[model samples]
Target: MYPFVRMFYQAWKNRNAPKLGLFESHHSRHVCMPWDIDLWLELNNGRTLTIFDLGRVPMSIRNGTAKVAKDGGYSMAVAGASVRYRRRVTTFQTVDMVTTPIGFDDKFLYIEQSMWDQTGECCNHILLRGAVIKKRKLVPPKELFDLMDPTLESPELPAWVQNWIAADDTRPWPPTR
Candidate 1:
């Protein structure tokens, strides 16, 4: 009877672990852990992962930029993503960042994000290629294109850049709700 009661008590206490962070162990400070924000936290930072997240797809689906839509707005489902790490980043290492919307075509949207260390060193980067589907088809409807093209078919990017995130022939986006 004593053993059963102790086991139940331990389980009950373990259920409410706010006193502990996700990876924090007993007596851990739980202060340096990172948050997986915007789904970009492929690293340990307490901030949201914006650019590598849906920033590219949303930018492509809405327009050549990550600019918010003017009408009722739009949502994008990421067809796929790929990231190539150039270097390692330790905890709390701050870096300068930049993002550029190269362009989009047919059923694919392409974007690139760069990260630079405090010393202006190129720390790492991610190349993203995604797709937009309105009804589970590769053919983007008039409304999607209408929303995308307001001024130019594609935006201009800086020189000295080349790595691109292109789409695979397979795996289309889920239909927009």
Candidate 2:
């Protein structure tokens, strides 16, 4: 089940947070609950992605994208992601999560997120490609930005992220063994 309550709480908690520009980071804090752990007694890999929602949604809200999405009758979806887990988070361990919009191409927006342990070490990081949907069609990032804030233009995507996207494009769909 989705953690709607926690998501709502995060939205409310950050309601007064300073508005962010396109390239600014949105910082949020979270803890590893019992349910978030796996049989190995650490935060589950899948749960990490789910928990990332807690940060990303609030980031959209803080940056005014959520409001624009709602008003425009659009929704955002994650199209692709690459993640790296470097450390284990045990039960009750607190982590500071940071989310930022790296940039967008014509079709997709790229977001970078990271979870840092209490001692300021990065535990995990993820790069996600997202698309906005409107009337069953994918809305280009430029169009979405025009609707949200015309003055705000997407920054250039980093070279590494562009490389990843290129690599993904080369992979054939419908795997053949």
Candidate 3:
């Protein structure tokens, strides 16, 4: 149910777009309605991660990191993800999403989304792992890239997202089943 009016009309229609730098790529565009299908009708692996939060909140407001997490009080979450789908999107189809920012280490911030289709293919792909909270603690994506710019930097995290962050650091947290 969280479409929040298409994520507030895609954060006020990309709030003037343009910015994006920490590995820029915020393409947007979507569709597949009919309640985003399921029951074998297509597109619905958990509503494709809740429609990828309408393309990662307009790619975090066109990469200004949602205004440096709303002026540093901070609050970005998605602590982990890793989707893949390959095809099918039925109802009104459309797609074109994109979203980037594939770097950061001192505690999360690593994104990558896709979802092409309309002939270009790539029906799905995700790899998020964000974080930055502040008062509730956990806030170190290089301090949200030193509050959004500080000469940017963060570019190395790739070798397959550092082997999926070293295989999610050997998993095993409380799941002995």
User: How does each model score on TM-score?
Assistant: 0.49, 0.96, 0.31
Worst 10 residues of 2 by lDDT: 148-157
Runs in model 1 deviating more than 4 A are 1-51, 54-73, 135-145, 148-151, 155-167, 170-177
Give one digit per residue, the lDDT tens place, for model 3 in 1-177.
877888888888888878777678889888988888988888888888988888888777777777778887888889989888989998888888888887887888888998898889899899989888889988678887776667767888879989988998899877797
Best by TM-score: 2
Model 1 / residue 124 / CA error / Å: 1.8
Q: Write the per-residue lDDT of candidate 2 for residues 47-108, one digit (tens) a residue.
A: 99999999999999888988988998889999999999999999999999999999998899
lDDT of 2: 0.92
- Each prediction's RMSD to truth: 15.0, 1.1, 13.9
Q: Which ranges of candidate 2 are over 4 A from the true structure?
A: none
Count backbone clashes in candidate 1: 0
Evaluated with lDDT, which candidate comes out highest? 2
Provide the clash count, candidate 2.
0
